[model samples]
Target: DASGVEAVALALVINSGVTLVKTIPLRRFEDAVRFGIGLSPVFTVFQVDDQITSSPHIAGPTGDTRLMPDPSQTVGLVASPGWALAPVDQLDQDGEPYPGCPRTFARRMLERLAGHGLELRGCYEIEFFLGHRAAPGPDEADPTPAHTGPAYGAIALADVEPFATALIRAFEEQGTGVMQFHPEYSTGQLELSVPHSVGIAAADTDLVVRHTIRAVARNHGYAVSFAPVVFAERVGNGNHLHLSLWNRNGRNLFQGGRGPEGMTREAEAFTAGVLAALPALTAITAPSVPSYQRLQPHRWSGPWACWGRENREAALRFVTGMVGSRPDAANLEVKSMDPAANPYLALGAIVAAGIDGLERELSLPDPVQDDPASIPARKRRSLGIRQLPASLTEAIAELEKSPMLREAMGDVLFDSFLATRRAERDVFEGQDPEDVVRAHRWRY
Candidate 1:
């Protein structure tokens, strides 16, 4: 029992579950987990070419056309401990947390949670698509759809056997801790489920998984996209996050029994806080333009901010089993997030909001009884359930106005993210949904 507590606490530092091998030595694990040195802001340099002439009498003549160099200084990489590459030096010899890394954002959020004497536990259910990068033709049927034995579908798995085997092996090597890989409802859709971990470690595992999946798939000449709306008019990918909260003493604070939704006072407060901050959180969860394409009604996407027991239609789903059990299973699945969204920043925003609710004693709202989309628009509106941000523009606006989100991400990261997101949104402003997906599908 105490092992579980130690595991949970240690897991806050590393991404995957700790496993020991018969052949592996204990000393090897000393450097097995790569916990970086520290978090400090980095600097950036810009090269410029334009030159101006100065008066000889006032100041020394700056050679306008001679060998003069012009340089500009800009804010360097935003530092977060969980980042994979160092933030400032994109080309540094040693690996550092990559810029725009979501894991770093989540680490920052965990730091914030520490300030309030709290801890977090999280897990991710990620969905994606697997396809041949260089097929015979765009119109030709993929010959390698199921090139191996059919684990699920006799015909499909056999066609794509090689791809499946290679991907699984690669994932294992990368320490992704992949629980299962299965064919989804769509033709090429695949889902990867991973074991849960506590605090920033869980979020970091997510980052490693996402990057490894895409990179390994590419090495096999296959392209993958976690875009929620990857296939036009077909089932899209979703990055549903399972979240829970704990006190500093290692007690799960979310387990409750008497509430209308089977949530405790603290749980209710956390949920209420998430609901209160969701309008802004969407910008991080569904950052891309195509994200809104899946957030529409009647698509099993969680457009409405309604929570209920086993209700997939609601944005927040209350997952329960029976009586007062483990709070680990008594968490909420935020279904609004997509694969393209940065997991770190998105999770951080949500955790910050939930912690805010606990601090302020916010009251939870009534859970929806029926399908929110079918409850009639006016009725749904009356219940205080509104559709999430329909586009990146609206989502950004909501984020800009949320003081909680701004404070959680800090000024450097918040500003850099907004700037980068604005640029991304602008480039895809008029592109078709499918075009947008095609251009950015596997880049993440």
Candidate 2:
């Protein structure tokens, strides 16, 4: 084992966005990798709560698959000694890549884009809340924020300096790039973003980085929740996605072009496609019940299905970067998504929508300069800005209408994903917002 690693975690992300993992001892790693560890296909439709939902394509106890860890991207965990993490690909008994595999779906999307001489560089910006360990008792009080300083204040950074500092070291030592990490707008909530990676690695990084955070936090006697909403009243966390398009020759397509904010026709078309598909995309990116609480208007969560330059309220916020840095730094920020999403499936869906835009040569509408909701109704309608799906139910309905997204994910994946979503909706039906938020508090 490299670095005296004792075990390796074979991690897989299912349609429900939960990371289901199996670990193997170092001595057995070769056998596990070559022959794969058996896993049931029913996991494809597991709920966030671990309840299984059935799909016509893949369900029940009749099917099996193998989880083969990717050795190329395996890494020793600096935060958790004697361990390593490797993302896995699910292959059916026939040794064929399974249609229900989210990771494989993401790779296929990237391959599709590569065929057009294009590529994506993307990363996840994760926000999470930290809570102190709860005392054991029947009358145990509520878990308190690990830090009491004002939100986003310097005092907040100082309060959690020890844990935060360890977090930084863990990331650096593990070879994970840390672009920025700091206090966020909610009490005990912190946000960190890593440098973008090309292809499925970005999605892989999302899982490993989150694992590193949880391990370091436990060592510091704190609990971590990447859930959309930790409490009913508090502002929820965001898993904002930052992405950019580039060509094989290393040119940034988002800048130095004739379209809006120097976007090339391809870039503009891609943006338009994403904007038009926000309603449908939510079924993948913001799949949780409490996810709606974070997607509300005025939360700066970008509930409006529109775009603007550096506008946080816009679903797609275009960043031109600082003067003279446009070529290297330009990217788009998707503010509506949260950590509850499966990044692989989310990224693939986003790319699929963008591909549709490019194929149709779609044009982006005029950017929303103000909050779309605050604008006069007539003006908002004229600008073509509409609020995205308000609930998981509505988002699922929109997804049902999207043939493009369904085709992108294929029938097996598409059917199983919907099955899980519908199961979640039915399970949480009639639950109050506070109850819903609490149920999802530590799931991710």
Could you estimate the TM-score for every candidate? 0.71, 0.97
**Candidate with the greatest TM-score versus the true structure:** 2
What TM-score does candidate 1 get on C-alpha atoms?
0.71
- Put down candidate 1 lDDT per residue, 179-262, tens digits, no spaces: 787776666767787777777656656655665566566656776766677655656678889877777777666665566566
Worst 10 residues of 1 by lDDT: 66-75
Candidate 2 per-residue lDDT over residues 376-426, each given as its tens digit: 888788878888998999999999999999999999999999999999999
Model 1, C-alpha of 370: deviation from truth (Å): 2.0
- Candidate 2: regions farther than 4 A off: 135-141
Model 1 residue 165 lDDT? 78
Off by over 4 Å in 1: 1-105, 135-176, 215-221, 322-327
Model 2 compared with the native: what TM-score?
A: 0.97
